[model samples]
Target: MNKITTNAFHPMQLKISQADIGYKEILISGADAQLQSGEVCLLIGNNGVGKTTLIRSVLHQIAILRGTITLGDKNIQELSVKEIAEYIAVVLSKSAIPQNYTVNDLVSLGKYIHYPFYFELSKEDQKEVRETIENLGLQQYDATPLKNLSDGNLQKAFIGRALTQNSPVIILDEPTTHLDEKNKIIILKTLRKLAREHHKLILFSSHDWRLAKEFADKIWYIKDRTLHAGMVEDVLIRHHELTDPSLFNVNEYFKAPHIIAPPLYKEMLYSLLQKNSTADLSHLSFEFMDNRWHIDAKGNGYQCGSFEEILVLVKTLH
Candidate 1:
C-alpha cells in the first residue's frame, strides 16, 4: 500500500461549507459536504451543472465565490500550490498527453514533486513507479510510447501516475471516460480497493452513474444548484432521477401476460409482449421450461426458441 505521512493533529476530512463555485457567476451554490478519508466518492450531475467547475474550486484552481472549502481546518486558499500537490493528487480528463513519454516515463513524473526537476528518481521511487505500473496492468506497455497506446491504456497510465503520487486524497475527472466496459470496471474497482485497503480519500466525477454507483461508497450529486452528498443508496433514493433515468416514457398500454421464467428472461418477454400490443394480454401466459418458451394464447398453444422468436410470434398475435 502507498502511504503518505501527515500531521496527526490535522483532521482527515474534506469539508465544504456553503460553498458557491464558479469562474465568474456562481454556477453551483449552497454546497456543503463532509467527505471523510478511506472512501470512494463519485461526483455526478448533468452537463453544465458545474461538476468540473466544482472540482476546480476544490482544487483551488478557481476561487470560490462564497463560503469555504477546507482540507482539515486549513482553508484551501491558504495552501500553496506545492502544499496542495502534497495533499491532493489530481488526474484531469483533458490533461495533455506527452508525445514521446513511455508508460514508465509518465508514471515516474509523479515523484518529481518530491525532488528537483533535473534530479533522477531515487531507487525507492523507481520501485514504486514500477509497482504502480504493474498494479494497473500496464506492464506490457511500460516501455511503449504513450502515443502508441490505446485511449483506454493511456487513461490507465494517467491513473497510475496519480496512484504513484500517493497523496492522501486523489481526485480524478472522469477517470473511466475513454475506457471500455471491462477497462471501466477495472479502474473503478482499483479505486475502490485503494480507498478500502490503503485508506485514500478518492473523489472522481463520472456520467456513468449506473455502473459507477456500485463502486462508490458515497455520492456527491449536484442538482438544483446544490451539492447533495451521502451514502450511495441514500443519495440515489433521495434523487429519484438517478434511480429512474426516465430514458423512455413507458406506458402500460397493454396488460401483461403471466410470465414464468428467470427474472431476467421473464421481464424481457413481458416487455416485448407489451410493446407490440395495445389490447389486453392478461389472458395470455408464458412459461419457460426445458430451455423453451411455452406460451398459451386463449385456447391455443405456441412455443418459441428465443426472445426473437417470441417477438415474431407475438407480432403475429397482434
Candidate 2:
C-alpha cells in the first residue's frame, strides 16, 4: 500500500481495470471517471452485466481477482471498510429494515457512520435527519412504521438514510425498480438536486436508459465482457460494438422518443405504430414521437405511420 496526502476538498473517483468476481468478469478495463466534487452519473446495462459487481469492487465489499481501484490517488484495497464508509454512502437494491422501526428511526440510522459509538443522536444530528426526511417529502411518514409504508415511501426512506450519512460520494443500485412513474421521477429529481445543489457525487444503476440519459452527466455501459464509459450519447450509439445485437436486443432502445412513458400507453402506442405504413421510417424524431403526429407537405399534420413504420423508423435512426 502507498500513502498519499489526502485533500477533503478534492473530488472522488474510481479507476479500475481487469477486475473480476465469482462467475462475472470485467477485463482489460480502464475508466477515468471523475465524479466531480458534485455531479450525477448513471450506471446502465442489461441484467447480469456486472454493473453491481463493479460497484461492489469499488467499495471493497468483494475481492477483486485482479486490477486496482483508486479513490482519488489512494487504492481502495489499502483503505479499511470504515474509511470507505466515511466517504461513500450506499442504498442497496433491497432493504430489510425492522418492520417495527419508524421512518425517523430508520433515517436516523444514517448518522451511525458519523457517530458510530453514540447511543443517542445529538441535537444537530437529529436536526439533520429531520431536515433530510422533510426534503425527501417523508415528513408524513416520519412516524409510520417501515412495513406499513408503500414501496415508494420505503424507497424514499432509504434515500433519506443515505442523505443522513452526508458522504461525499453516494451510490444506489436500481433505486427506481418497483416504483411507479411518478415515484421514479421524484427519486431521479431528488438525486439531481443532491448532485447539483449539495455538490455530492451521485452514482446509481438503472435499466431505464431514457431516464439515465436525461438525468446523468455520464454513463457507464457494461456488456458482454467490456465496460464503456462516456457521455450517454456516445456510449448508447456505440453499443453495437460491445455485444451482438441479436443477443442483447439493443435495437429496441433505439426507438424514437425513447422517453419513459406510462407502461400501458407506451406498449399500446408502440404496437399500433408498428402496424401502419407510409410513416416516415428514417430517423427517430423525438419531437415527432411526443407530439403523436408529423407535418406533411400541406402543413397540416396527421398521426404518423402504423406501429410497424414507427418501429422501422426507430431502428433506422439507430
Candidate 3:
C-alpha cells in the first residue's frame, strides 16, 4: 500500500519513477515523469498507450504495479483518499452525475473534499465556487440543472468543479472531447491561466495537438512502451511531423472567402499539420468560412456538406 507522509507541505514537483502503468500485465513500466507548479502538461499517445493508466495511477484511483508515484515529497500510495483529494482533482469523460444537480451544485462538490461530512459552505468557499463558475462561463447556468445545459456547458461545469477544489494538481481526461473550437480555446486558456496565475499543475490528455502546442508548458508523449517528456519545442522537434503541416496545397496561397473563414483561417490553412485534399492550383480558391468548406472554382460556387466533398471537388479541378 502507498503511504502519505504527514509533511503535508507543498513541494515544487510531482514526481513519478519506475512506475508500472497497468495491472494483470504491465502495459508500460519504468516510466518517470514530473510536473511542476505553474506548468500545464499535455499527455498524449495512441489509443492504447496507457495514458489513462498513468493518470489514474497518479490520481491514486489505481495503484501502480511497481515503483513510486509522489506528489511533492510524499509518495502518492501513502496518501489516504481524502488527502489525495486535496492534492488532485479530476475531470473524466462520461460521468454519471445526477441529472437534478444544478450547475452551482455540481461545482460545489469540489469543495466537499475540504470539509467534514454534512459540511456547510463558508462564505469564502461560496465566493470561490461562484467565481469559478463564472470563470467557466457557467453563470447563466448557475441555477440551471445539469440535465438542462448543453453538453458543452455541462463539460464546463465539471471543469469548474475541478477548479473549485483548490487542488495543487488537476488531472483531466480528454477535457475538450465534445467542445467546438471556441470552447476548446476557452478551456485551454483557462488551464494556462490557472497554471500561470494560480500556480496549479494541470495534467490533461488531449488529441488536440495544435492547442496543446500553443498552451502547454510541457508535452508528455507516451508511446512504444516508453514515456517521453520535455518542453513543447523540444518534444515537437523529436516529433517532426507535427510541425511539418500541410492543411491544403503547397503550390499557392489562394484567398479564402473572408465571410465564412474562422479567425486566422489563412494562418491555420498554411500551418496545418496534415492535408487530406489536393487542390488544383488554377481556377479554384478554397474558402473556410463558418467552420465549413466551400470552393469557388472557375467562378462557380459550391458549398460542401463535408470535408470529403471539398476534397472531391478540389480533385475535380485537378
Model 1: which ten-residue window has the lowest total lDDT?
243-252
Best by lDDT: 1
lDDT scores for all predictions?
A: 0.84, 0.71, 0.78
- lDDT (Cα, tens digit) per residue for candidate 2, span 184-219: 887889889888888788889987777766788878
What is the C-alpha lDDT profile of model 3 across 1-318, one tens digit per residue?
Answer: 353332426545788898778967787868888888899999887788888888888878888888998887788777888778887889987787776899999999999887874989999999999888888877888899888888889899999989989888889999899888898888999999998988888999986667666889898888778888889889888885554433333535443223335545544544331243333353556677676767776678888766566556655766
- Worst 10-residue lDDT window for candidate 2 reads 241-250
lDDT at residue 46 of model 2 (Cα atoms): 76
Position 171, candidate 2: lDDT: 94
lDDT score of residue 307 within candidate 1: 87
Runs in model 1 with CA error above 4 Å? 1-11, 245-318
Q: Report RMSD for candidate 2.
A: 6.8
Error of 1 at 128 (Å): 0.8
lDDT of 2: 0.71
